[model samples]
Target: MEKKADQVSVWCIVSMASIPLVMTLGNSMLIPVLPILEDKVGISSFQSSMIITSYSVAAIFLIPVAGYLSDRFGRKKVILPSLILALIGGLIAGFASWKMDDPFTMIIIGRVIQGIGAAGAMPIVLPLVGDLYQDDEEKASSCLGIIETSNTFGKVLSPILGSIFAAFLWFLPFFSISALSLISIVLIFFFVKVPKEKDEPVKFKEFFNNTKKVFKAEGKWLYTVFLNGVLVMLILFSMLFFLSENLEKVHDIKGIKKGFVLAIPLLLLCTASFISGRKIKGDIKTIRLVMLSCLAVMSIAVAFVGFTNKKIILLLAVTSIVGIAIGALLPALDAIITENIEKELRGTVTSFYSSARFIGVAAGPPIMSIVMKNFLNGSYIVAGVLGVILLFIVFKFIKENEIGNQTEKA
Candidate 1:
């Protein structure tokens, strides 16, 4: 069952890319349609936000375990089962919405199931790319960029797709998740081939010890990257959730039209991330510098939003800047975390990083609900402060490519 590393086909890459693409859409696609969901389900914004939180919370705990399992077994083995579980989770949510009188609890429980599946499918894509091109660093780097781009592309499309689905039937996006995951499952099963790993599987104790050693040496920088992941997602999702309401209620925009306006920042993010990833490439110093610069830029833009006087154009423009800043910073975070980690430990470490990001996603909406209700004008200010704190952390703790040099030497 061992395959040649160089045998990687374009179809193979495309198949692998589908996992993140679909998994992201499963969550993000809900944002635009949340207003409708709130009304249909007779749920408060806070309650509706729990739908998102439930999914993320499940992933937040399970991703690290999925990472360990992927390392111990094989990437495909873990991913295939995860997609099946996600598909089932999607059905439960969809049916509860469609068929049940009191579906709220069922829907939440279903999302938790989906979240469990998400923990495995989404984060595993990273280390799998690294494994696929073990012999060719350039191709590994290129494919990683592709994976990130696919993920961002999902963000760009999700709102529109979600809105379109909702416009037809309020609960349709829930069912769509099942369809999307099925496609990825098929593509990966038939087309992709993982080269066999040569290393013996490490036991739980040794695995835990290795993780400790890796974290001990690089914890300063890795923890910074993990925090950055969380904060960026927190800002991104909270704003999107906030804006979805603003568009539907305040601006009287809804359906596909609203989805497009919401997509503006996401489009900016998707475009900028692709450009940033290409430019930063494995240059650790460049990655850290870009991230620092982006954090500062985003912090300023978010604070400016507090003073925008609610001018539609001004608000959108400023938020767009925040999106672009995130776009630039994320690729840097990914590069610094994964490229520097030794291959054997990449799955566990990146899973932890992915899990941290989910913490932000889970926290964003409910926290934002409170922020908007209590301190509406200061929402931007509070988010800005978090950005500034993260910027300071990156500058002080994230060494400039030093980890990369150390990794190369080791």
Candidate 2:
């Protein structure tokens, strides 16, 4: 029986890992193909960009609800339905792009559906991993580390995949994302098997009341840490939006050349995430030190991006620095939150974290684009300043608590 349980645990990790991979791959795959969509769909640039924003906007509204449902029901219940929704969304977008002459409205509708589906997928997966390895901090962190790496890996490869598909057909990327979502659905059905909670079902009104109590119970410092994590995402993505535009428009770089430049930072980010996952250990103070150092490095890198004229090398270096910072920051934040929050409310709190992150992702590009258009000279400076502000919040507000009890092994 013990051996059987261990085997189940291994399967659970693999299944959970797939969630991030599907989300990451699907999200990243579209970055390279935006221009193709513009020409094929006959939409304005703002409309084309909405293809990305629609998903995130939907995520912002749906994630908290999904998170609550997962906690009240079960992870698998939420995940399976979400995967099906993603498939529907993907097919809609692909068909619209392929068969319709006026595809923008259809595509946006599809993206919104995908975003709602995504709300149920990625955010819940983290807490599921927490559920799987409840008792061992190191093991749980390691699991999250793997998930984060897979996420970054998807970002790293998406452009390459997107470029290849765009060469053949612009609509191919949506199909690719749909295929991944389908695969994830199959994996989850076969592999994930967490025992359902035995507690009596809580009504929606009662659930929100419980959530309110949890929010009130958590210390101010914990909430601040959560906000800092959100800010990190916002700053990183905002910079990415600006950097991608700068390389393409200002530097006159396009096609694979632009993709290559954009990829450098992601490569560094991937490397940094892997390294941080392996090296980071111990109390909140240790985590704080690592986070602070990463933030400082990121600040320097963004400042360089603002000041430099040699776009290629500057972009590469800055990306590396920010990548390293973010790589460390994500898992560290996850581990911190998981360790600090009570077990019963973990999913709900994590949902809030996910919502904050989606907010950042949704806001980053448009906000940065506006800044670049209006104050081209000061965009990177703005990003750098925000990074510093995050750093200050972390150092001053975050507290050092002992790591909590780990999730019980299956």
Candidate 3:
């Protein structure tokens, strides 16, 4: 039974990891091709950004509902259907791009469907991971790191892959996402083994009561995590939007060249997330120290992007450094939330966290576009300032608490 559980745990981790990877690829992959999409669809820059934001906006609103459902039902039950919705969305978007006279509207609609699916899928993984290793904090922490690494890996691949698909045809990326989502669905259905729950499903009234109780007790620290989540994602997507736009508009770099160039910072981000996920484990001290240091590093690096010139090498170096900071921040935040929350409450809490993150994603590109249009350096300055604000919140709220209780697992 022990060996079997270990094997199931490993497979579950792999399957859960794929959830974020596919989600990132579905969204981030389109960043490099937004210019092409703008031209092909005859949309304004802001409208093109809406392509990305629409998906996140939908996810932002629906994520908490999905989280609640997953807690009430089961992870796989919620996840499998969500992937199906994403697959349907991908196919709809791809078909519209290939055959329709006006594909933009259809594509946005598809993205909304994809967002609904995303709301249910990735957010459920954190709590499911907690359930898998109920007693072992170290293993759970390492597993969560692997999950974060996969998410970053998708970001690393998105630009390169999206650009490659766009080179052949602008719609190919949508088809690619459909294919990826299909694969994820199969992997999850066949191999991922969720541990059986012994407790009866909580009634809606009790669920709400538990949720209220949790916030009353842990609201300060949890709110800090939520804010940090939004800030990091905002900084990340904003910088990516800036880099993708600048590379094509200013340097005339496009196609695979642009993709590879855009990927440099994300590669660094993936590396940072992988390392941080493992090192932070379940230690609250580790989470605090890592987040504080990384937030400082990110703020300084983004400030440089705003303050400096359009020198290509300098921008890449600074963005790459910022990527490292974000990478560390993500898993640290994930560990803090997942390790501390009770299993029944984990999905709901982390879903709220994920929703906060989607809000950042939804806002990043459009806001950055407006800022960059007005003043090139202003975007980076704005990101840096936000980072500093988040750092202070973390410093003030995230403190040493007694561990060992299920709700306060340190």
- Candidate 3 lDDT (Cα, 0 to 1): 0.89
Give every collision pair in model 3.
Answer: none
Clash count for each candidate, listed in order shown: 0, 6, 0
Model 3 lDDT per residue over 1-410, tens place:
69547645566678889999999999999999999988998898888889899999999999999999989999899999999999999999899999998899999999999998899898988888887777889988999999999999999999999999999999999999889999999999988887777889999999998998888778888999999888889888978888899998888999999999999999999999999999987899989999899999999889898654478998899989999999988999999989888888888999999999999999999988788877767667777888888889888988866322434421
Q: In what order do the candidates fall by lDDT, top score first?
A: 3, 1, 2
> For residue 151, what is the lDDT in candidate 2?
76
For every candidate, C-alpha RMSD to the true structure in Å: 2.0, 3.5, 1.9
Candidate 2 lDDT over residue span 1-410, tens digit each: 45435635766777788887787767666766676676777765556557777888898888988988888888889989998898899999999988988888988899889999899999888788777676666777777777777777777777677777777887888888889898889989988877656678678787777667656655455676667666777766666666656776678776666666677778778777767765665357767887788878877677666566346676677667877788777777777776566556677788788888877777766676566666755766777787788788778766564233222210
lDDT per model, in order? 0.86, 0.74, 0.89
Cand. 2 TM to true fold: 0.91
Residues 176-273, model 1: lDDT tens digits? 99999999999989987887666788888988888888887788888889999998999889888888887777778889999999899899998888
lDDT of 2: 0.74
Predicted model with the maximum TM-score: 3
Return the TM-score for each candidate structure.
0.96, 0.91, 0.97
